[model samples]
Target: MKLVVRRSVCFQGHQIPDQEAACQQSYGPDLEYRDLMRVTAIVICAALAGCQAVPGEGPLASAINEDAGRSPAEIGRVNAAVFDIVDVDNHTARLVSDYVSTALKRRFGIGGGPGRAVIGIGDQLKVTIFEAGADGLFSTNDSKQATIDVVVQPDGTAAIPYVGTVRFAGRTLEQARQEILASLKSKAVEPDVIIGMGDTPSRSVTVAGAVNRSAQIPLNLSGEQITDVIAKAGGPTSQPYESYVTLVRGKKTGTALLKSIVENPSENIYVQPGDQIFVTRDPRTFTLLGAVKSNSRIEFGANDLNLLEAVALGRGGNDETVNAKGYFLFRYEDPEVVLGLLGQRRFDELARKGMQPDKDGRYPIVYRFDMSHADSLLVGQTFPVKSRDVIYASRHPAVDLTKFLRVIGAPVGIAVQGAAISNNLSD
Candidate 1:
């Protein structure tokens, strides 16, 4: 009472070899192919059930599952509160006109150099007195030359031979010479004085950090600038494009890109006495992740970098896997900017929850760009990329589907092949 049966199974369009053909030819009526068909159906059903058990668990699925509880409308509501959806054109113009233009107008005033250099405390002076007589009070024998080295004291005066103390601090070289001549006039007949600077410790700017040489450059009557100080310090250790200069004058401080300081005259402000200039290799960088060609930190070579340029640097979004509509930039934006984007009511709500802006008055922001349209290419050209930004391009639905199919198809194909081989071996 032996029964014969035939079964056909396919996994992802790959047909399983016919086990019944060999079984029927070798075992005749003794072999029951119905059992083999039953086993094949059970294995495939188990595989499909396993896949169905974890539906929507592909790469992109899992990646987006974190926010799956929220619907699209709800997600839009949440994003509207914390995110800014701007077209490329509007953001591009806003960045250039608002951020860059404003920064260029901020220039520190530098004093014009007077005819005579002013004297200050801690300055070393070389005084030479010339007498009209053969042997004056400052002269010995027939020599009229009397050279004296005196450092300007804290009291702003310098000691002179028989001339008492002369106040030289805050006085120009010509003014100090006149004061010295007036003092020596009573003691000697027609005494002429020449005062020269031996050391100029007070009139210098300190340059430090990321330079070939850290030094204190003297500020002369020519009026040195920020660039001049950096040059005197042997320039920056890093590339100018990849470096920044910080100028600290007294209590006030300002920072600009080294390349900008070199190219833009306004950013190359005058370097004053006691000003500290630090050249640092702290280039503005953004982190690229997800479906980008390269997922790493990308440094900006210049002062301005738009979204298109940033994406190009990351090798453009992965064409095969990226979701064109889901490109995002994560950043902390100024509260005022966020207010302008999200409106005052939503901002106030977030503020009430103790989500205060940072020291820079900026709140957490996420910027989404839809690259699905051709016009978005123009928008990406003008949208600026700020420092510490995170750029991400989500995966496409097809990529997730392909991944899901692979997960299920592999085991089913293996089971079909194994069942066919076992049936052949048994026969």
Candidate 2:
């Protein structure tokens, strides 16, 4: 329906006497006065209408639906190389929510029991020799026992007073003592030996990056796990979930979140000799885009973040602009996880529709969750927000109506003010 506005005429602050005759009277003698006012109203209306056109284009989901590929009709819809939109449901939420980080646990077995505590090359050891007779090698007439500090050489041997060079590397402290006793028995007078380990350079795990103190933590005879060494070096400087611990043992390396190690004890593996640990802060975050109140990148924080929590973090959707049914989460899903979840037949059908995998073997996917229904809300509560995920709140169809009314309102406001003035000169 065309917009119609009616209003009573007033002069300054008071209603004009004989309002009908006063409105009919001319404002000026200029023959061009009434025509100028009428032309101005038409110009303002056209400008406002043109301005609303871009913003009034329908909901974002409509645009995606228009360009959709013929992916498996059952496996959901795909927009080809751009993205794939899947309306999340209860069954899909159950399967996708099961996705957890097993990066460290899968590669390195969780059952990392106590490791060997053998003396390595370059280890420091204090050896003491005791003899029944005073006049003997490594002992004076005044003292029965003689103590010497020695380092395990790179060649896996240590030099002694009478034993020449003894190999201590790969031997337990007690075992090394026995070997030394045998060597001293042949030289020193009735000698007994004792060997003790000290702080060593080779048998230590180096802890650095995002820790209170970056240092080399010495391994004791008992055992030192990943957490033990991190605590010794003054723990992670950031939140446990935000902290990632990378363990480099020899040529192999494995990384796990500090939260994972604390929550799952089996993940806290024993540190080996010469192991290097790196503690880095990597906050898990997702981008909230499109018709949200505030477009931003928010952290997942110390716990798992769900779709509902993420929407709150994005300051919820703009009610005037966003659709109740159009929130989409964009992610490059691992083809293996998705294919396994979808089963081979459905995925094969999707591939046949020309929706190919990317260079990283990942499929570009968009998961749409309608917030209008109670079931969708419950399903969204279980759906997880992953790191680097993008959430786009699509525009509402009413946004076009809202903008169109705005354009109409501009012309209406002009008509209400000029109705009397324009009617007078037209006659």
Candidate 3:
């Protein structure tokens, strides 16, 4: 089939002047410069306006799968809900990272550090009685002192000779010793008493789960930290980042990453007797999605991962399509933590807008960090990436326009060229 190319295209029912003086003969060659400019502007504006309506190339599969990939048992983890997006900066990054509601030192400390060791049930105690002179009731002339074994019963009371049964479960060794000496003075010659620790089986920290050897490490007067107890149990069975140390003391339970305890000395808190130390393996990971080179779950190493390093682990965003400014990380943030990032003013604004944390005391939030800026790049290098966080790199807006232009640009260019040639011929 023969193809025909129309040199003179229709524009709002107007005829173009051909080389044979087509427009000059019919509608007169005066198309008016102002009218011409109006038409030109409309054409240019129409092309520019189409940029907004242009769509991206394709919806690629995410590095992190959604509900479709989750097992029925675990599918609840991919619940989709409306969330807030906050802009991240150096101040926000630092505060949100370091913020912890109950730090080890704050929760377990007494008098700026772990308090003096107190006698507890299963703590073995021995009392030594010293007489001023010769034997009275028990001490002979040959030996002026006598040692007696003391046992703390499950009822929180210890049975001792002369003293009978006294509450000693929570008392210090010195206090118990003083009580014994006072009780003995009434029955014997001027007496003094000293208390010393013996085999203490129940006065120990229980170290269980993901360790080389699960055991109950005995606590001494010197005291032992969580790390010390874990080390004694043959250390964690996993990497520091992958290991979790949970301390259950009575009704309170505190958990910290093994990596954090190693890096921050303050987090390596002292373990009290009867404290349950559970060394569990919980791998720290982040989901890399959107325009990244490799969209997959990335596991943390021995150290905490910075934003830049996390991105690097995903091979950063796809070079051509990634919008550097659209880099975002999704995480469930605490309310107080939101305050740190938003500041009082912005936080109040959100509160006024009826924004609140969920039942879990966490705000479903995403932090946007514009890597397009040199300063943000620097900040991202040091900004910490939390475990289970979701990182997304959006496609640039210009990418859509580029694709749209590639398909329609040639026709627009040809039309403009033909119009110019017709105008020159009319002149």
lDDT measured at residue 159 in model 3 versus the true structure, 0 to 100: 75
Q: In model 1, what lDDT does residue 63 have?
A: 35
lDDT of 3 by residue, 20-80 (tens): 3332222236656565555444443333344444564333122122322233344343334
* Candidates' C-alpha lDDT: 0.67, 0.72, 0.68
Query: Model 2 Cα displacement at 24 (Å)?
Result: 36
TM-score of 2: 0.68
Question: Candidate 3 — worst ten consecutive residues by lDDT sum?
Answer: 60-69
Candidate 3 clashes between residue pairs 3 or more apart in a chain or in different chains: 63-295
**Alpha-carbon TM-score of each model against the true structure:** 0.63, 0.68, 0.71
The lDDT of model 2 is 0.72
lDDT by residue (tens digit), candidate 2, 145-225: 988999999999999987888888898888899988988887888999988888687778899999999998888889888
Candidate 1 lDDT? 0.67
Best by TM-score: 3
| Model 3 residue 269 distance off true place after TM-score fit, in angstroms | 2.9
lDDT of 1 at 79: 39
